[model samples]
Target: MSALLAEDLLNQMIPPLKSTDTTAKAARWLEEFHVGQLPVVTGTHYQGLITENDLADYENPDTQLAELPLRYADTYVQHDQHFFRIMELAIQNRIQLVPVLDEQQEYAGVVTVSDALAAFGPVPGPAGQGSILVLTMEERDYSLSQISRYVEENNAKILSAHVVADEHDPFRIRLTLRLNTDNLARITATLERFGYLVSAQFSGTAAVSEDEQDRFDALLRYLSV
Candidate 1:
């Protein structure tokens, strides 16, 4: 029932290595655990992260981590931080795994990018079933309360809504909403009559008409470009 936290994704399978550990051992563990990096710790105090690329510079395989110049030492999330923050930091730092710290600022564990993504993939779940509607309007005209009022006026409730800037026009925004009703004819009509552009519509399920599928495929290609 609770949202996932940074500590929830902590992967103990990839254990932390000590500063006195050899580069040979770190490299071996990275390969064994199928990870790009490993945490170097001095008991509860996190020393920093030692990555595969970082070890490549070492001429000797027996070199200790304490003698190595570590990167992403400060790149870590607090245990209580949101799961989204973990992904943000991972992408920002270009690392495959993120470190988590406890209340005492001690190394709690690490969260893999894959684990965080898997946990996020099914979000806004079944609550946002039925129909999905998209509207394109100027950023200044966007109002959640006004839109909710319109949906409620049609005897429907918006399950979830998200806003993104129009790719072609930064001044305009694309609002996507998941409603509780599949029959969106009345809602769409009322919105269009009130000067709102109903850009797209989709049923709750993945099944779509051939024509719609073609358009959806084209849209995916365009976004990828």
Candidate 2:
């Protein structure tokens, strides 16, 4: 499958500001666009990202962006970088927007967390015709090949897989897998037979519950802010 790169999700419509632009101008753009952050550039070169909070302490709206404390000046990914990289940077920095740069280190555009997730779609969800199986195990015992083999034995294929570290237990991990079939009884049984703990199962044939939809919306709102 082709990788979803940064350039593919770039929001060219979201304009960048010049360093000479006043804080007032940046703030206006933020309000107008309903975004918390905006990228500041010098000619084609990216300076850094500026947030509304960054300008809150500044009494003078006319202060030049060059004089203000711009953040994440070096926090940018290449245009060709995978979208996952963009997501990592956004989450790690707790920022809503990530800047993309060209090979010459010039500003390309910015990617909003909302846009990134929208492009990512519902991978391990009911949006696609597949079943979701969540498994929890010791980090050391996790192996994709082994898991795949168990599923394949039941004549099932994994459509997508995601791994997340357990927050309370660092040595444990949670694995969420999307299978190509709605019926997960056989695959679940096979995995448990091999000592893999299946924590939750969602059938593709079932409609996504209202509660789950609410949670998704809440998560997206939190990330966007």
Which structure among the candidates has the greatest lDDT? 2
**CA RMSD of all predictions:** 10.6, 8.7
Candidate 1 lowest-lDDT run of ten: 216-225
Q: Please provide, for model 2 over 10-72, each residue's C-alpha lDDT reduced to its tens digit, 9 standing for 90 to 100.
A: 987799989999989999999998888899998998888989889898989899999988989
- lDDT of all predictions: 0.76, 0.76
| Candidate 1 clashing pairs, residues 3+ apart or interchain | none
Output the TM-score of candidate 1: 0.57
How do the residues 1-225 of candidate 1 rate in per-residue lDDT, one tens digit apiece? 234577777887878999999999999999999988899998889988998889889979989999998888899988867554565576556678999999999999999877765654433434434665789899899898999999999999986666666656879877777677767888888898888899877653445787665543432222222
Q: Which stretches of candidate 1 lie over 4 Å from their true place?
A: 122-225
The TM-score leader among the candidates is 2
